[model samples]
Target: MGRRIGIKDVAAAAGVSATTVSHILNEVEGKRVNPETRQRVLETARELGYAPNGLARGLRLKRSNTIGFVSDQIATTPHAGRIILGAQEEAAKHDLLLLMLNTGGDPELERKEIDLLLQRQVDGVLYASMYHRVVEMPEQLRSVPTVLLDARSNDPGVPSVVPDEVLGGRTAVRELLSHGHRRIGFINNVDDIPATHGRLEGYLRALAEAGLAEDPRLVVTETADAAGGYRAALRLLQAAERPTALFCFADRMAMGVYRAAAELGMSIPADLSVIGFDNQELICDGLYPGLTTVALPHYEMGARAVVQLLALTGAQDQGTGPAAQEMLPCPLVARASVVSPPRL
Candidate 1:
């Protein structure tokens, strides 16, 4: 077996005392060392391929420069690549390593993962939910510096970074209204969910802002999935006050809306206009007329969450401030799905 290279070997090659080498390695300067000497020592260490044992350094500082990333089944999800890329960029900037653990969409497994991360002595934890929903965080995470990405929780102390769903929702509705859509309908998921409720609030707020009375019949609250949206659209179009423009909570649901419209002999933007959210790629490509949507900046959000977590970890270690909620605004992307209301 090859002998392990230690600080002593680098010190000997650099002509420096063991203590001086220790100081330089720890970045603790008791005495000012000449720049030339410092450079030589660093070079010798590099040439020797000598790396300080990370475990020893962590023990000395009582901290590990590693952060835990607890996420849903990102490995299997399409948007996973972008989000992971963002997180990696931010983590690299902070000189921190990420230990990612996926929960595979199981809350029980998520709980176990959190425990495992805590056991690993990670400095902080970043909890990322695949979708915008209310997450029940584990009790063990309360003591650790924790951040939630793309999810909301009742705990005020657990800071969250989420896409501004309300803003995105309003943007979707405003665009449709600008194109002369007054009889606008909504395809939303169950109102109990946080993101769903936020979108619903934005939808109602937009209607009220436009001086249009709320038409209960035009709003269909269902699963907001493709199939749910399909069924809801069928009933909505059959009604006496059939809406000419529809805003759905998700792009998947909007795909269902497209199916319902086709069955009713309606051509997009000609007899009906549709807009949705999330901007999922498949939905956009699958539709006959590409769906216009509110893009959530999913990748940016994931990266921002990592940056915020790093910041919080530093601040907490320094006793700087308490954690708080932050949000990123989503933007609208226009496509061929929507059109001006039928000629007055």
Candidate 2:
């Protein structure tokens, strides 16, 4: 093997001091090295294959330049790729890497995996959840700079990033209203989760804004599945005054609604308009008259989580203010499903 290239070699080759080479190579801030010298040093370092020892450098800087992405059951979900991709791409922008860990919802395993990450002296962590929900702050994470992705903590002191459930819900309903459907039915999720409540509030808020009153009978809570959606749709459609449009809490529920509509001999868009949430591509694209829906910003959530973590770790100068509870808006994905209601 040839002699290992070092800063001295690059300095000699570039006709500059070792200190000048180090400052330029390490990218130390506030240095006033000449641009010509800096460029020549960089070129010489590349030519000589002079690579700095990342471990030694990290030790000197007291940072690993790596971020830990720890998630529970996210690997098994469809949105996992987008979320991971978002964080990974953003981290790469800062010449950082992401060490991912999936705990499979095991609390003990989570503790152990987190310990492993901490052992590496990671700059910070992104504690992500598969879905939008409230999660308790893990005891192991408190000592480190952390940001919650697609989840929130009860402690307002911790920063978190989540989709704006209320706005998403309102966005879905507004799509229906825009198509001139006033007698709209919202098939909401039965579970008492943030999404369940936020969407409902959005539904009401939209109706109120449009000078319409909330019809208690128009809103029904179901199991948030195809079966539950089918059951609810049957009840709503069988009524003497059936809804002209239906807004489902989830795309899965919309599947049931589609079946219910077919049995009742309703032609979608012509006889009824339907919209769903969660924009699961499989469901949205599989349906005959493709389901128009609201999409959770999974990719954006992951990217923003890193942005927040970078700020917390003082790696980036982004306000980094105390405990930001950021909420991103869910955008509408238009497909073949939504249209103006049938003429009376």
Candidate 3:
């Protein structure tokens, strides 16, 4: 409806050269502009409603300034909202937009969509997985700067952001141990993912740190679901020397554990102490007395993946070195489920 305000317009209004305005607006690293001048240019640009022409900038810089988010079944994930929200908010801070595509696990569709994104000149791409696991980067994505989300690769050259599974598992066990739980059991997932193996290592590490010998029978692998949790809990609790506490690999499995505990006439944190991972609030909060658990850094993972991608594409410094695999720590979310074990 009106003539667009350009950088030159803001520069003229702010009594500075267009180059100065460009440096301030583009946030070119190592450019020394006075803070007062920067503030004035920003204020003037805001007042004049000046918006850079994305097309002109992209053509000149040979970059779209947009990222491609390619995911498989991310929508079906309960924590997907938080992950997307984190990425979107962080990208906005860098003045970048994400072009999203969900391929529904169709490899052909994924490749085609990625090619379409490349055609649009996206500066980079985030190849996201619904859960933390190992994934091979697609051939089409190799042509562009890419980062994996909640996933890792066999190739160290591929950058990624995932949760520190070992640390997370150790954290959960340490919490239980702090409450005087030495005779503990682990309800693990049978899947051969990083989480499955890393968490098991963490469990063993924490036990050793406490000078407790490993009891091979205490760690049981199940299907990572409520039914599996129920089955695992029954086996552990029915033993001659039942565990005083149990750490579940997932909240859903913890739900089944609750069911088993009830059937066995066990009161949580009284007859048995319980903890879980993933911190799925619906399961954690809905359970009576709540469920103390270790929370996966879903939002942080998304944000960090963008940082890795930005580094890969040379979009931002992010004060980091060469793009490499990064793992964020999972923190403890405390509730009412875990406490000192019952005096046997």
Candidate 4:
């Protein structure tokens, strides 16, 4: 490979000193350089296809201007792509670059990835999980400015930004209750996952407020994917006392619920009303008869997380404590998938 062009090359091409080039490229705050100088340096850099050695520059300035983003899963899921888009947009606004790492949901791999980012000297780190669950990050990361998105960590050192899953769950139940459906069923992969558990808590809370005791049989806990929801819906419909309405934890599971209802020759809303979370656009628009869902604001969450992370890192640079945690609210988007319960 050819040797990479450096600032020196640009300075020579622009007929200016290296210091001038540096000041123009870094764009020092509160230090105004001549606009003509800035334009000349930029033109020279472009003409020479000059790329700064970010790692070397970071070492000299004691700042990487790069943030590490580690996610539990992204390669296989379309969800991760959206989060990335949001993060990239925010990073651009702050003139920062992102170094992405995927752990494939392995804790050990996550630990290694964190170490690698630290070695590269990132300004901060953001850990995101595809599913809402408790994560055990590397102990070495205690010194790093870290934030989490879409999941919570027991380690207080790391602040988090997660979807208000509990509120989303509450919204689902309330919508059904408002439609006069008391006998509502819940479908979740597990009651153990933080996101699932929080949502379930909201569901129970809503039921209690309505003066309804939870029927154990109406709550279906299985795997979190489409297959899990499919089987759970089958059991719910086959029960001697079937629920008039169902709230699925994910859009994927809602797909399963739709299938089961169809196989049983049940018409939506008229015979069985359904609700789901995650408000994924494709699932919401592509459902056989459409699906009512709770909008997650996932892209917005991702963007905000990166922006907050930069603020925290800036604080630390000024010899201050880490920034406080940020929590964003979830909003519900209504679509056609629910109706009033059948009259006795």
Candidate 5:
């Protein structure tokens, strides 16, 4: 291709100085120029195909029109890819670019990535995780406008956008209860994770709300995987008076539950109702009977983090406020996995 056109070319074509061209094209605030001259400069630039240099413009304005997106395993996971897509789409809407870097859960690599992003003078930083948990922010990240996605920071000044796990847990139980299930079993994930605690709280809350006594024998905690689910489900189903319905902490766990049910010669929704969290289509839709589950709202959390970061950076007109800890809602996705308990 021929030599690319620049602002100097536009200036020459419009018979105006390069400074005047810069002022008109960049819309430098508080600078006054004749309307006809402004129109002429714009038309000439367009005709010449002149494009502004993002790096140079950012240097001059002391603000980069770029966002640094740092994630720990989220980029590599197929289930959470929508989070990146949502952030990218929202950034484009504001005419900004996203520079993504995945650290694969390496703290040293994460620090290096943040240093590189800061060197580029990114306007803001978005720290995301594959799952919702508390994150320790790197010292370098504290200097810039930053927001946490599907995670929380120890620093109260940093804002976070995550799904409401407690609400999700309650919704899952309510769905089972609505189907006339009085005896329910909860197959929980490991006890240390924040989600485990929150979900258990919701389960207890829902049972209390319905005037049902908590059954100690009905609750079991195991690893957050299919094997764990299988073992837990076996124990729950083998009891003399087994629960008519089961609520799993995650979709993967629910898949294990399905296996256990099949082994016991039980059909889903007919013999035993089941519900799961995380509307992972791979597991939920692929099951013999589509698994009813709750969605984590990954996309909404990603999109809202960008919006909130922009507000923190004064890039948007939304009112400024104290650091926000926003929890987006998790909506239930109904499917064939849940039904009324079978009558004796």
Candidate 6:
């Protein structure tokens, strides 16, 4: 309604040049300005309600101070929402605003969303997925400072922040082995996905380390859901040498194992020890006995993606080297589902 306070008003009131005020407010590195002048300029700006015009500033600096976050169903999913929260928090720490967009796993929608963000002149982009997999990055992303979250590009040139699935798998099996489980079976996801391969590799590695033979009969590949888990569990439980413990690829599948165990009149940890991955709280905590599982590190992946994207954007501005890929660790969450095997 009234007159808008400008940077010049703050400079005049603070008894300083516009250049000095710009340096102090924008925080241009290595520019030596007196502390007293800096404090005075900030106080004057606060008192005058001076807000910089984002568009004008962006045009001048060729940086929007805004990061674009594009995800395929991660933003809308309940369990994966933490990834967005983490990215937003980190962006705020650097005084950057985030523009979030969801594509619902549709390639056409993905391209449209990316084009829209580019048209808006976002400083950089963060591409994320609901699950860990290899994604083909759109050509538009190649020209911008882009980082992948919870996914990797087939091209090694793109930077990504993803969970260490192999380590998570090893940790799950190691927890079972520590409880004296020699006959442990694995209910795995289908072989095509990246997580399935990495997790299965860890499973086999842990078995080899423990001097146990790899048993084809003890492993079953499923669809990574409740129905698939139920069918796979039935097959394992009906075997002549039924496994005493089971490691599921995901918590959703673990729910199916619980159902099968119930049908067989088997008690959790008393008759069958179980462990799962992706520690979805709704499934894990609501189970009769809380399910012990490996966390997917969704929050960490999102936070690290922002950190990497900012770093890459800064590096590009400074003519530095290329961005590097990062993988965050998944921690084990102990609960009531796992216990020592019953003595035969």
What's the CA error at residue 24 for candidate 5, in Å?
Answer: 7.8
Q: Where is model 5 more than 4 Å wrong at Cα?
A: 1-50, 315-320
Off by over 4 Å in 6: 1-51
Candidate 4 per-residue lDDT over residues 163-204, each given as its tens digit: 777787888999999999989999986757767778898899
Who wins the lDDT comparison? 2
lDDT of 1 by residue, 281-305 (tens): 8888778799999988778977888
Model 2 lowest lDDT segment of ten: 312-321
Backbone clash pairs for candidate 6 read none
Tens digits of per-residue lDDT for model 2, 48-119: 999998999899888899999999997568999999999999999999999999999899999999999999
Rank all candidate structures by their TM-score, best first, as comma-separated numbers: 5, 6, 2, 3, 4, 1
Ranking by lDDT: 2, 3, 5, 6, 1, 4
Write down the TM-score for model 6.
Answer: 0.85
Residue pairs in collision within model 2:
none
RMSD (CA, Å), each prediction: 3.8, 4.5, 5.8, 3.7, 3.5, 4.3
List of clashing residue pairs for candidate 1:
none
lDDT of 5 at 209: 93
The window of 10 residues in a row where model 3 has the poorest summed lDDT is 314-323
Tens-digit per-residue lDDT, 98-169, candidate 3: 999999989999878988999999988989888999999998888888999988998998899999999999
Looking at model 3, residue 63 earns an lDDT score of 81
Give the local distance difference test score of model 5.
0.91
Q: Which wins on lDDT, candidate 1 or candidate 6?
A: 6
Clashes of 2: 0
Residue 283 displacement (Å), model 2: 1.4
Compared with the true structure, what per-residue lDDT tens digits does model 6 show for residues 1-344?
59999878899999999999999998899999999999999999999999878888888888788889998886546656788888888999998888888989988998899999998788889898888889988898888889999999878888999888889889999999999999999999985988999889889888988999999999999998999999999999989999999999999999999999999989998999999999899999999799999999988888889889888877876899586778788899999999998888
Model 2 residue runs over 4 Å out of place are 1-52, 315-320
Best by TM-score: 5
- C-alpha lDDT values of all predictions: 0.84, 0.93, 0.92, 0.83, 0.91, 0.90
